[model samples]
Target: MPTDDMTARPTTSREDGLAAEVRTLLRTGLPIRLAAGPRLLGLRGVQARARRPDDPSSLARALDGLLREQLDRLENTGLAEASRLLFGAEAATSGATLTARRQAAADASGYEVHHFRKRIEPKLIDLVAWQLRRDSDTFMARHATAPELRAATRPLVLPADVFAWEAVEHQHALARLWGAVYLLRAELLTTARLASMDAPATETDAAATRALWRHALVLAAAAEYRAAYGAALLDRAGDTDLGPDQIAAYAGWTPPLSPAADLILVRLADPDGSLADFTARLDAARGGSELTADWRRALSGRDRDTDPNTLPAAAPEGSTP
Candidate 1:
């Protein structure tokens, strides 16, 4: 006796047929065609989710839900608009003629009529076909055991958050500055912890320890500048006297060094120890070139070329990935 066939196999032909059907629905732009397309195509996922698989109204609603959910996930605005126009997703265009839909898609995508027909339209159809297959597979895997699970697993559409490039960069720079401040604080705490435990002072030289403290002070000052600058940009709920250029000048502002920082600079400048040298060095370090250089470096290091929309793997400092 021959064994029954139980192996799972790819359905390339069925998928191809579905893709062709989706293309027809997109190109026809006729209500009668769209209303009958999903049922005629025998979309298993749509049928499975519909209250009555055989009912055309139920299948149409299910298909609409799937398209809307997937379309909302698309980040590309132009492609989204094209898809919407082509599929008559908006009520205003539901009764539009095929030529009108084509022209609208071309205008939305910024493509010429010939180019949109030859390139963009095919891509739109393929995108829909792929979305349908993915949703179908997901529904089948989750709801095969109990059809009642469909309601709980149904997808929701939410608005996408879009930010300007400048705003994104500003926020990213602020984040980097704050991150540097936290790291410097952690190092300071660790040093204090070691001192409290009476760890060997030989681990770090006196000069190196002083340098670390100086760096921490400078970084903290930079972080403060960035916070105030960012607040000036975002806190626009009320009227302010400052103009845009005046606000921007804050980026290059030089903060005065703290007393501790001044003392450290004095010690570095005159290790031999003299009252006159201490006084002169302390006065010079208040807004000196060295302090300015350090502040500028700290600020520039935080101004990375990273895209705020993505979270790429960490790279070495001062390196672009």
Candidate 2:
């Protein structure tokens, strides 16, 4: 799991900051849904029969290891100190809600809003619970000397008194927290992925998971969507297409376990192969990306006019993508 920073640092394709970093990790890394246990176990069984065997755990395990690597980078980068100052007090509070304490911790640590929105958005009672389990006096002592800890709790400094690096340092902590939080989700999702990784999950479950994830991915990839993706996707999907349990699984990090589900999503996203005449014709003319754009824009919380440039020529104003 050890990585040489100078050598192993990713040659990132863009500098769009934390959002891009997280998205890249999500896309390039193992789906997290197939991280371990029976599913991975079955994969090993499949590989034994093939001439060109694949190491499934390279993704299932290594991606998780990568997440931890990112977390260590954060802690060593001074996020641990940031946590000590910003969240030390309230995190040690006897009766505070875990949610409030987590927000305080994340805020104090300097996590950016965008980073929080994308990577650290999941449930995080574990971090707060870890903090709360500390002895009260020990908790207070660790943060007692950190001036920013007090400064964040109070409004002592003028705007001009603060330097940009201090803000940057705080923001740096957020990136660390985001990766760490994802590891937690990875653990949970992998469990579910491992569970449903078998034949136990119904065919309907796979169908629903694939539909929802594809819709969500399209919206997440597109920039023009102004409304909530959830409301839009659900509005279009029926109870049969996206079950409540499937929704929870997807949200929690469970990947669609079905090979059929995986293939369905990939084919839809890529828009190739045996298709209806109009659909194939549309792909041929406007390009597969444009059709995806139409679908993504169509599935929004509120109905809005689609950008003409982004959609295929035949994609009518209000029609589903």
TM-score for all models, in order of appearance: 0.37, 0.18
Clashes of 1: 0
Candidate 1, 195-272: lDDT as tens digits: 455566543223224334434343444434445563332322112222222332233222234555534542433323
Candidate topping TM-score: 1
RMSD of each: 22.0, 25.1
Predicted structure with the largest lDDT when compared to the true one = 1
Give the clashing residue pairs of candidate 1, or none: none
Candidate 2 lDDT over 1-321, as tens digits, reads 111122222232222232233333333222343534332222222233222224555444543443333333342243443322222222252234434444554565467644543444321212322221221113222111111323367654546535565555443433332333334344444434544454333432333333333333332222112132222222211121332223323334322223333233333433222224334433444344453343333232111364433433223222224
Cα lDDT listed for each candidate = 0.49, 0.33
Residue pair clashes in candidate 2 = 110-170, 111-174
